[model samples]
Target: MFLGIDIGTSSVKAVVVDGTQRLIAAASTPLAVSRPHELWSEQHPDDWWAAVEGTVAELRAAAGRSWAAIGAVGLSGQMHGAVLIDGAGRPLRPAILHNDGRAFGEAEELNRRLPAIGQIAGVPAMPGFAAPKLLWLAHHEPEVLRQARHLLLPKDYVRLRMSGSLATDMSDASGALLLDCARRQWSPEIAAACGIDLSLLPPVLEGSAVAGELTAPVAAAWGLKPGTILATGAGDAAAGAIAAGAVNEGDAFISLGTAAQYFVARESYRPAPEHLVHSFCHGLPQRWFQMAALLNGAGALAWAAELLGKSDIGAMLAAAETAFTGPSPLMFLPYLTGERTPHNNAHARGVLFGLTPASGAEQVTQAVVEGVALALADCQAYVAETGALPEQIAVNGGGARSPFWMKILASALGKTLHVQEESGAGPAFGAARLARLALTGEDPAKVCTKPRIAAEIRPDPALADAYGGKLVQFRNLYRAVKPFYQ
Candidate 1:
């Protein structure tokens, strides 16, 4: 058995799988994000550790006899989070998350200082990236920078606690903007521009490589065998791509989690920064992917659900399905946390138009869902410019559970959407597969096979036609509102 742990924005998920890739046991523990001020998202590193402990304990109780057979632990997590650690491996402050937009000025400054940053990093220096976050701290909290000895991404920080090692995988490290993405290593030039020391970064490794053995103390406390191997896992999106079998050229998947991503796998590095597409290293060696990410995705739906006094997302989606029929006259701009992909506007904010006295909760809810679909469609259009459009897209994440949303997404993109039986498993399952590869020395292609397709959503011509028109309106709305954001 292999174990996979995914430290996500909202939860910590752990799963155990057998050699054949069947899930044996799974568990998750909820996590909370703190918004101490507007445009900032932070999480306590201790809370992540506690959540991981709870999740592992749950998995242990559920796995029973299978627990002892587990040979390796793999990790997957949210990318680009900046976790500052002192020499003793202690967190200096709350980790700044990828969704945080507090470093806009720093991002601009870094890009200005290094004009070749986009070419070097394979993506523009954006506020949510690790390099910009560090630059922000250097200017605003110099003392913290002075005391910091190392920088680790979210999952790597957890790995440090579990294995007493400071290491990260190329897939996760690629998003830091300090990496020479083409060379698949750290770039001293970029680091110098950001005023960061190369030594502060962790050693980069392949996703399937053994990072460290689980320390005896952590193993003993968790009722597990000592010296269990731990694989250097990947960032959430890359892991999710593996789970969906998007490891070859032309393979793609749409991730609708806290953030949305249109990910396309490639055999070689292909940078398209002009379209704001993110090109980064794949979890597997010698592979890369072009991705267009949006800051808001299912999280936007959650926000709308809360505003409508609904507690359950599934129920809210059902209500939205029955509440409206065609394209919503009420258009929503899902820039709640600003946006990435095609438009790197950090100042953008959510906007709702065409409100009427007769409009009710249902109209607002449907519009929110449609708005997200439209934004993702924009991402699809940008990715298509770089290569042939994907024939089909594997849909996963929280939004994939909703048949209504799946139907809407298919119609919006005018492409068939394949829903895997293990769609909800997301990155955790992929991490488990990576663990299997590490433990068995099997080929990643063989170990990370795609799951069975439980269902498929095909676009309806009528709905597609309507969405096509609404898409034009969506673009125009953004253009009209662009000036105000600046």
Candidate 2:
């Protein structure tokens, strides 16, 4: 059996996959994000380790003998989080997450000061990227900067705890804004511009490569053999792509997790910064992908559910689906934590418009779902503008479990979406595949095949015109309210 661990924004998930690629057992532990200030989002490094340990124990119990037979391990995690570490390998503070918007000004300053950074780093500097957060720290917390001995992404921090290693995969490092993505190495120019030293970053490697081995102490505590190979894992998005077998050129998938992304695999590095499409390294060597990322997806629905006093999002979505007529009269902007792709507006806030006396839970719920779909529609357009849109897209993530939301999203984007079996497994399953590769030295092409298709969702012709009009209104509303965000 092979093991895969995904350190997600809201949880840590671990899965055991047998040699046949069957999921033997899976476990997860929930995590919380701390938003002490309006635009800040953080999680203590200790919380991540705790969650990983909790899930590992659960997986061991569930899998029994399979746990002892584990051959290799792979990791997948939320990308772009800045975790500063001291010389003794202790975190200086809470990790700044990818959704945090506290460094917007720093991001803008970096872009203004270095125009070539976008081309070099794959995506333009954004508040959510790691380097800008470092700049924010340099200006606000110089003491922390002075004492920082190393910088690691969220998963790398977990890797350090697992194997006493300080290394990162190319796919994850690409998002840090300190990497020369095309060259697959750290860019000294970019690092220096952000007041970072070259030595602060971890060594970059392919996600499938064996980066380290489990330390004896951790292996003993976790009931695994010492020196078990640890594969340099991927960013969650790249790992999800590996799960869907979307590694070849033109293969595509849409991830609708806490954050969403419209992704297309590419054969080579093709930066399209002008269109705001993210071009980054793939988990596999000699591969790259373009993505349009959204900071909210199911998260938007979660927030709406909380506000409407609905404890079960599935039940709420069911009610909304049952009451669905045409497009919702009300409009919602799912920018609860600002946005990433296309707009890059960190100050944007969520909005609900066209509310009336009749607008209750159903209306609000439907609008929130449709709002996320419309935001994805913008993503689709911008990605298409760069000539990378695929004909059939695979859908995955927690949100994709809702058929109603899938239908709404399909209509909004006007594309056929294939819902694969085990789609909800997402990145953890992919990480397991990477683990298999590391153990057997198998060809990734053979190991990372697409799962069986469970269903296909296409656009509803009857609701096409209504959705088209609503999409227009959605764009218009954002423009009208842009000044308010500033």
Model 2 misplaced regions, further than 4 Å: none
* Candidate 1, lDDT over the whole model: 0.90
Clash pairs (backbone) in predicted model 1: none
TM agreement with the true structure for every prediction:
0.98, 0.99
**Would you list the clashing residue pairs of candidate 2?**
none
Poorest 10 consecutive residues by lDDT, candidate 1: 315-324
Q: Residue by residue across 1-486, what tens digits does model 1's lDDT show?
A: 999999999899999988878888999999999999988999999999999999999999999999999999999999999999999999999999998999999999998999888888888899999999988998899998999999999999999999999999988999887888899999999999989889989999999998998999999988778999999999999999988999999999998888899999999999888888999999998999999988899989989988889988787777778876788889999999888786888889899999999888888988998999999998888999989877689989888998988888899999999998778788999898888777778888887777889889999899999999999999999999999996
lDDT of 2 by residue, 388-449 (tens): 57768999988889999999989998889999888888899988888888778888999989
